[model samples]
Target chain A: MTTRVLVAKVGLDGHDRGIKVVARILRDAGMEVVYTGLFQTPEMVAVAAIQEDVDVVGLSMLSGAHLTLAPLVVAALRERGSDIPVVVGGIVPGNDVEDLTAAGVAAIFGPGASAEEIVTAITTLVPQGH
Target chain B: MTDNPYKTWREAFDAAPTRDADFTTLSGIPLEPVYGPEEGEFPGAYPYTRGIHASMYRSKLWTMRMFAGFGTAVDTNARFREIIAAGGTGLSTAFDMPTLLGLDSDDPMSLGEVGRCGVAIDSLADVRDLFAGIDLSRITTSMTINSPAAVMLALFVAQAEERGVKRSALGGTLQNDILKEYQAQKEFVFPPRQSMRLVRDTMAFTAAEMPKWNSISVSGYHIREAGSTAAEELAFTLANGFAYVELAREAGLTIDDVAPRLSFFFNAHIDFFEEIAKYRAARRVWATWTRGHYGAEDPRSWQLRFHTQTAGVSLTAQQPEVNIARTAIEALAGVLGGTQSLHTNSMDEAIALPTARAARIALRTQQVLAYETNVAHVADPLGGSWFVEELTSEVERQAEEILAEILDKGRGSMLEGCIAGIEENWFQGRIADSAYALEKTFNAGRRIVVGVNAFTEGNEEEDLAILRITNADEKKQVERLAAVRQARHAARVEAALATLKRQAADPTINLMPALIDAAKAEATVGEMMGAMVTVFGRHVEVPSL
Candidate 1:
């Protein structure tokens, strides 16, 4: 069974270069991909993730709001009683990784994350629950 | 008679005040300043394939403009003073995401983004705080705002007027090119046709009133960063510019009046030769169109002046310090390409906002290139090189091809076609396809990005201490926004916005005066933009991946 993933830009940053590439990466790896468009608030993203019923949700935040916005996204998912794990990507500093992890973000991908690494992380996080 | 270019150059070389610098290679081998080219194709001549100016950087080095902004107006103001105090001639402002989107700091849509990406500005008070100590008359500013650019520029002029600076005394460039926002950047607010009206309004006002101002800096920088190829960036930007030229004619503005005040902004991407060729191709294409298509008589109308910024997408988070080397190479490419101004990317930008140390290094990169390197001593130094000439011509051909497609899409009207293309996702789909193709090659190990795919031994990202804006700053900005609302007279703001709304609905009225009135009444950027939005319903792009 193929895993499914939802990639979303969760804040005001309009930069979708990496996430677009990630969508193709997962698609080529035989995983289903859903890309929610830009400027999504946490609630909108959570609603989309739950409605889409994806195995994992990936949020791209390049506008340095990841520290403040990513955790809200995690809590937003929990608030709606969805345990779909979330991964935060883009320009995340090393020092903030612990806080993001503590906030229940499952994984973090920075600028240079490879396609194989991203696919592996997604597959491992969502375990064989197609 | 069309004389041979070499002989013409020879006669002019002897008659003109003999060039003052030593024309020699590093080993002191005597060398000619520049090789010959066609009479009509030389620098400062028709179609300006070489450069818009004859001397190029020999007389004036490209303005070393550094883009800096973060946190609040106070925070960005300190940085501006430092840039000007440190011998930097120009200041390029980077507004925070909320400000860029025309939201007040307290707007719910602006949560956590108030000061995250750049400075948080809500009112004319914020603008006053932004330029507190800096003399507005002396320093030139370039604002990177689009959707709300008219409001931002109005606020700026109001601030200058409060300081007793005449409107004519101001100098700056407004990134009023709304076409690219729909095509790439995705920061658009109104429908493309309505947005073009706002852009045209600014052009009409600035072309008449503010002689020193550049009304529309039709930009390809964001398009390139959003994954466009070099030729695509050039073609799309020039296409948007031509759309404005046509739109201006519709508004009763002449080509010569608006064209001279129009400028361009481009990206100096990682590919060295390709980036240089893109700039050369850009000048040729712009000059040819402005003359043949627009029927402009002023020579200034034919010259394409531009500012170049090193590509931010090329910077990597792994081994972040290596970006310094990359920025230097890209900056050198911009200089060689004859840019009118430049902004070099800071090394640590890929990881976070650039730390002060990282920003200093970026500025020093330009200083070294401008002063230490002798690349600027001669104009179009590579003019006659076979490889460069061929690449330049090829890039020109490719860009013209792309422009033709866009023109056909509009059915001969670029403005209409761009709006059609946006609705059809033509630009977004093409960019995504190109980006995916490159990603496929990298994933297949066919293309190597150092420190990522190759040279991975002992590679570690050094702790460059990236700049981070805290939520505390957000709270502070919100409080300031609250205070501003409480202080300003509600009646004044309401009346001003009422006028703006009425004028926005009537296409005949130039909205600049009304916008300036609203700003003078201390109306927040959001309220002013909201008024216009009500008149012109909001626009949302169709989702594309």
Candidate 2:
């Protein structure tokens, strides 16, 4: 089985550099990558993740809205009866990272996290479960 | 041979050599060991390759305009006072994410974003609180806004009027360069043509009424952040600036009237000399185009005065304190390269919003460069350097090529060309390619960013004091917005919005007066923008190649 990942940018934030980079890395890692482009709502991301049956969902935010957006994404995934692990990356503060982790985000990639680390973390978390 | 005398040194160098190849700037501009007059033109002269002003900082230091905003208007107002009190010269305002996107704090879209990134201002009341104790006439302000720049400017003018300050007395630069938003920042609200119309309306109105206010700050800061090469930043920014000039002329404003009010904003990145050369090249290119192409007679129209913020994209979360050194170097480049104003990034920006202490440190970084470094004592100190001049020429050559390409796309009309290119996603695609290339280099260890790639410290992020906006702040902001909505006369707000919608529908009418009226009626930012969106419709990029 190959790993399947969904990359989504929630809300009105348009900082897509990090998310786009991650999508490329996942695709290069031989995973099936589905990119939800900018200005996506929580429900949109949730529906796409469920429909794609992704093993993991990755969210990227640079606007400091992870505290609000991450939980909504997690809850949306749950409401759709999906158990896909969630990972996030961007300029998220440490406190927010803790909060996001507590809110069921499986992993957080900060500014210095390498593509290898992110890919490894995803592979470890999902383990080719798609 | 004469080289036989130094044969031993050469042999040693060959054995333990440099890592790879010859040194070059981040933009891949080849540098020389020395610079001379053979490189280009002189400072404070036509085709200003050196300095725009002959004396440069010797006559007056560049303005220490730090971008301060966060939490409520009152909070940012207090921060502004603190910055002024700490020997800062001018003010630059940063709006919250919600406000930047033209949403009111009470809107569902604005739920968790209020007061997170910058100060939240939903109405003129918030603007009034933002400048509560400060005298508008005493200090100049530069707002980092687009899409709704006219609304923000109107709010400023209305607040100034409440303070009995004449509209002409206020001074500031509006980041009304929406073309760059489509290219880089991606904080766009309306379609390209409609947004350009709004920009043109503001330019025409400001040219007539607000003589001291800069109607547009043609920006390259976001372009650089969006992963463009230095030359690409220069080319795209100047292309957009020319498009605006063309757009204003199409709207029937003379070049002399609106040209002087057009300012620029740039990014002072980690490459010290390249950043300096980028500024020098920018001045030369603008002067050449404005005088030769637009036939501008005024020196102000030919001069390229810009405000620079040290690159936030260059900062790293690992060993965040090292960012202080990075900022100092970048700020020095802005000074040496001749900027009108500078903002150094806070050390903690890579992690979160700067705490007050971090903000002060950022300001002190500028002060140290201005007063202690003594680099400002001479005008274009590196004017005749072989390396600097060569880099400057290379930047100019590359930028002019891009500019020519953009103009060619316009089919003789730069504005049309910009519109066509934006709709075709040319600029966005170019930036994305550049960004991808840089990321590849970084990931492959070809480019060594100090704390990120080269000098790897394992999980070095310690206890960092990052600014956090609590849930209480959001609740308070929402309630305040609710109270404002309840307090303002509903009929007046509706009437003002209706007039805005009417004006928006009619391209013949300038929308500034109606926007100002809407601001005065206490209409929220979202309401005014919502009305316009209803008239002009909203826009979203496809982001596909």
Candidate 3:
């Protein structure tokens, strides 16, 4: 099965180099990837995730707005009654990791995360039934 | 063993196996094992391949201009004071996203984003607060803003006037480069033609009125950050600069008139020798093109002055302390390459806005490089090296090819051609391809990043203190913006914006005067930009299929 993932950048952060790199990495891994480009609102990301029926959501944020923005994506998913596992990456402070996980994020990938680690985490975190 | 004296050493050297890897640079320039004397004469001469100045750092050290701004204007002002106290020579301002996009801190779209990435400057009030105690006459201030750069420059000029300083006496660089915004940074607002008009207005205004200020700093920093090769960065930045010169000429100024004030900004990535070569090549290419192609007569017009920032993209959030070494090396490359000024990225920048302590350490890296390392004693110390010469010429040749391609795309004008390229997504496509290729190589384990691919460390966050901006900061900024709106007379702002809109519609009239009037009237960034948006529609990039 081709693992479907939606790589998203939410809020007003214009740094897209990291997110673009992640999208290409996922695509190279033989996964179906849809990128919801820069300045995407939570509503936009959630709608895209549902429409694409992605198995995992990889959110890339660097403006220290992950705590505010990441939870919105998770909550929007909950509002839609979707169980797509969300993985957050990019400059997530270590102290906030446990909180984000507690808030229903499946995994957190920081600056030095390898492609294998990221791909493996995404593959394992997604439910087999999906 | 053989009887010959060198037989054993030669045999041993041949027996040892070397790693089978490509010896080319990121731009695909081939490298040799050693370098000796070759082409190119002494530094500080015509066609300045080695450097633009004779003394280089020996006579005057490069300006240590640290890019620091976050939270509200007052907060950033305090940071500026701290930077000056800690021995920084100049200041570079980084505006927040909303401000960069020409939106007020109180705009609905600016919620939760106020003062997050950089300082939020809504009106002249914020700009005034930004430089409260700093003497504008004494220190050079470089602002990193595009799209709404004219508006920001107007605000800065207004601040200087308010402090009883002559506009002619004010000195600094305004990153009025909009072409790069369209191509890489993605901070563009109005359509291309309209945006260039704004850029034209600033160039003409500064060249005539503010002779001491650099009207624009043509930047390749963002292009490199967007994953361009060194050659691409050089070629794209120089091409954009050529377009600006052409635009100024069309606007009725001679090339020499505007060209002298023109400057450049580049990214110093971790590739030490290659980075140095890139800068050297950049100067040679710019000098040749401006002199031969543009017919620039003034020596200053032919010289390429640039500022180099240590690559922010190269920093790693994991084992972030090691980034100090990375910055030091990159800064050294910038110095050796003869940068007029430099900014060293803090180790923690990859994670969050640089903490005050982290920023100080970053500044000190430059201090050590400038004062301690005697490498700055000579200009282009590697000028005659065979390897560096090959790399420099190759970089210049590749950049020339790209420039020719861009010029051909424009028909006759590089400016027209670049606008065409932007519309056709030529620049974006090339950058995307380069970025994707680099990322693929990193993923395939062909390239090993110390903390990333190899010697992987788990979380070392326990010891690090990342700068945290709270929600309270956003609330406070919005409140400040609200108060400014209340205090200013609404009629004055409305009248000034009307004049601005009227001038925006009439392309012949310069918008700086009208914009400065708006700034004086206390018009917010969003309001003034909104008025212009009425005449010149906003730009919404059509994503590639």
Query: Which number leads on lDDT?
Result: 1
lDDT of 3 by residue, B262-379 (tens): 9999999999999999999999999999999989999898899999999998998778898999999999999989999999999898878998999999999999887665666556
Encode model 2's per-residue lDDT on B1-545: one tens digit a residue: 12342332234323432323333544666543223343244445567666665445545678899898989998899999999998888898989888888999988888778898889999998999998887666678888899989899889888888788888887888988999988888889999899989999989988888999999999999988988899999999999999999988889987788888999999999999999999999999999899999999987889898999999999988888889999999988998898999898999999878888888999999888776655665557787787998999999999999998999999887887788888898988888778878888888989898878877665455757888887688888888999999899999999999999988999999999999999999999999999999998988887542
Pairs in clash, predicted candidate 3: B410-B417
Which parts of model 3 have CA positions greater than 4 angstroms off?
A: B1-40, B457-461
DockQ of prediction 1? 0.77
Q: Please give the DockQ score of every candidate, comma-separated.
A: 0.77, 0.56, 0.45
Q: In Å, what is the interface RMSD of model 1?
A: 1.1
Task: At residue B534, give the lDDT of candidate 3.
Answer: 96
C-alpha lDDT (0 to 100) for residue B108 of candidate 2? 84
User: How well is each residue in A60-82 modelled by candidate 1, as lDDT tens digits?
Assistant: 87898898889998899999999
Candidate 1 vs 2: which has more TM-score: 1
State every prediction's TM-score relative to the real structure.
Answer: 0.96, 0.93, 0.92
Tell me the chain A TM-score of model 1: 0.97
| Index of the highest-DockQ prediction | 1
Report the lDDT of model 1 for residue B75: 95
* Residue-level error in angstroms, candidate 1, position B511: 1.0
Candidate 2 local lDDT, residue B221? 93
Ranking by lDDT: 1, 3, 2
> What digit string (tens of lDDT, one per residue) describes model 1 on residues B1-545?
13665555445444455445665656787755455745435666667877887656655678998999999999999988878877788898899998888888999889888888899999999999998998756778999899999999899989989989888878999988898888888888888888888898899988878999999899999999888888899998999898898899999989898999999999999999888888998998998888987788998999999999999998877787789999999999898899999999998898877877788889999998877777877778777778888999999999999988999998998877787888899988888888888888888899888888998764663566778899899999999989999999999999999999999989988999999999999999999989999999888776778
